[model samples]
Target: MASGISDAQLAVFVLSLRRSNPPSDTSIVLFMDSVSPRAREIMEAHAVEGVVFDKSKFGDIHPSTYRWPMITEAVEGRGAAVGNVLVADIRDMAFQGDPFEVIGREGGGLHVFTGVEHITLGKDGWNGGWVRDCFGERLLESIKDEVIICSGVSVGDRDNMVGYLKMMSSEMDLPSFKQCERNGVDQGVHNVLVHTGRLKGGGVDVKVHRQGGGTVANMQAGVAKYRRGEGVVNGEGRMVDVVHQYDRDGELQDHLFREFVEWDMAVEGVGEGGCEGYIIKENTEAYKGICDLSHDPGSDYLECCKVCNGKPNCRGFTHIRKGCWLKTCGNNGNKELKVVGATGAWKV
Candidate 1:
């Protein structure tokens, strides 16, 4: 379910799930292109099972391209087994309760949830506007007022989930989606399929879960409604089963993560490392940068470190051929050295 090195956010996500659900009732399956040493260590520490895939199958396509195919492979490889399948974004997520329990309460049908954004199509939202432009005026005019669907969190029974992912993968190759061949297309196609009832065409029952109203709470646009408590509660004051896109709000994200860290320490007697006044030395090949997680470039090493330092959970940064890559220390802030062509530094 993750593609790269394990970070602090990923640790928080898995740990939250472990804390919320007992292993006897839940199992964690991780799918990755390749597991890094740090990621492997965390997986061993948490007893998470991993499935590795050959990256060449998808080529050097967008990260969104891997989403559906991976899900399809995982579900189908299990013989289309009967169980609730939750496809979630690992980074920037934390669990307050058992997700399967919430889904069970929803009567055990197909459900897709979206993170709410403040801006809408043809307005100030750049991504939404691009989607509108790609589909043209006529198509957008029909659903101009519809809420944007987020592809981050999706859940359904095994058969339905596999069917949904297969549909999405097929739709991505269509001529109509040619112009939409960029990032966020997965979400665009998801919205189109659900809003237009394409899933129904395949005899799949689907329901749209909106932010602040569903078992899963998307904080992308509803950060104000998130208060620091035992768990995140929606506007109606009900505890949400799953929370997504919290990293969009730095203050709230930091608070929630710190809360989890405190809880982990108090309950499990575990301690975490801190990064303060640390700098990654230049020409260090071990911590070579793999990829840039930033949306933009042009940040120098000092600037990148400062940005990472200012962030609540950021522990280190990798400056490489591409750009700056920020990292979290997870349980241990100590930077793991591996041969690469980038420099890594840490700060608290």
Candidate 2:
């Protein structure tokens, strides 16, 4: 279940999942917000193969918290007919194999994924801050050495997943948790539940699977091994079933975009070559329609600039959130705009 995911990204996730698992053996229900016409088309195309899209709304609550209750309600509606369940982020995830293969038909345990080795929750700045913000420093210190368990993905049997979601939904209902509108605060709550034995008390058999040790790979943490088409693999060298945060690697993200979503880099005007000799400016962006080429979304600033350099008469570029606007300039160079999380570069 996800909100604000682009149509391109939705295609990648749903198509890849359908590709790996036959509809006869698997059922897919996607809970989404504001489904566009194109998104409806994509979902409808797969509806015959057991893909169901349910438009969801949770008012103004942050998606991280609202998704839990919504998911819980959806699963509970299925009653005894529901089987295994895999809760995952849609925008940045893709499947390379049958995700349920490892869990099996009688999925009995709540399986969660952790980051790669050596990146403990306490040691990481962003994750650590999330813990401190939500649970206070004392609670964080108790499990400071624990590896980061990403809340974005998890799999279990219907009962176990529903149980875990119930715990999460009830906790997020508290006044304190409701005030945490920021994204990623759920991670703190999730870790607290697992390490403090709260989940176990709720009848959830939590099983922690480290990166490369399980069916899922947290790409942001790092992967020990990866295959070109297969993505991250385990210590045993088998291809992982699901890959999360794959956008961290620009090349691999592009590969999946092209293969699964049919993202046409050539049509998008992305080309090779570094931004050598190009001036670098911090926190700048080019205004729209300044370039011959349209804006292109990439993984980072360097990739944006590289796309600019690859185009003809490209004089400058503005970048933010993996988007690049290649710009053409007059003899005086392009005018700069001040935007946070945005960068602009130009040549004299």
Candidate 3:
């Protein structure tokens, strides 16, 4: 759930949450940015009954939405409020474990917690290379799952949420900079204020969970990157989560799927969490080489940009491990908007 959750997947996610038997903390507020009418419809359908619709004051928009300067715009507010809250992805589908059981109250301020994707297996270690390059090896331990902590599943208390948002929004110059759930992204953003040495003196342990997604569905065959230490692929020789494009009624659209199927076949089937194109963030590296990269050097990847540096993709990546998967745009190459599957089938 850290990196993906599509409109189709989100529908199932909301329905599933509503269907969970034991029921979870009523305080959990599902927050997301809406773009098109279709996306909003999906949200309204999945929303809990009786909960009044309140636009996220921060006004978060999807990465595709042109209003933002940052890839993820929702982590701007978190430390002002004091109520318990959970922020999960739309595809985080099932809620097997009771969140209240996992989230307990701590010292003076609340301590939000979340599971960080393992550097090689879970989180995108390579993209975080800039942090390492900027901060060095010691940062590897202290700031280990920094990005994923900000991007993945999270739990927060109001005070910490708002206070943290104030710091990030102001310090980072986030837009509008309002205090709302939209600012509640994963990264233990309040780490410095809440989890620092002062809290440790009180024996507070605000740390990353290190494991995401529970056992059942997570154990499915096609989900793992490798089976018995070997590469994984479906019976059709296509990778897991193939982007098959189709019409509204679910008809195959081979032309759209061609690019990805071509890219997949070309790359010997991209690794785990493969994508037909970037979500403006390119190549679901989670499926491919997205290993415990943050933990080990091998878990890393590099970006190669040249245009901005006056070269194009070759301009110079500046050593950051972020870039969208290249697209064939007018022979020059650009990131695409949507990923149409190889055979024009339903993506969901």
The TM-scores of all predictions, comma-separated, are 0.71, 0.75, 0.39
| Each prediction's whole-model lDDT (CA) | 0.64, 0.73, 0.31
Q: Model 2 scores what on Cα lDDT? A: 0.73
Output the TM-score of candidate 1.
0.71
Model 3, 225-251: lDDT tens per residue? Answer: 223222222334323221111221111
Candidate 1 C-alpha lDDT tens digits along 101-136 = 756777655787756655554353644554575566
**Which pairs clash inside model 2?**
284-343, 284-344
Q: Evaluate model 3: give its lDDT.
A: 0.31
lDDT of 2 by residue, 122-178 (tens): 988877787777778998899889888889998988888998999988888888865
Best by TM-score: 2
Minimal lDDT window, size 10, model 2: 263-272
lDDT of 3 at 104: 49
The lDDT leader among the candidates is 2
lDDT of 3 at 302: 24
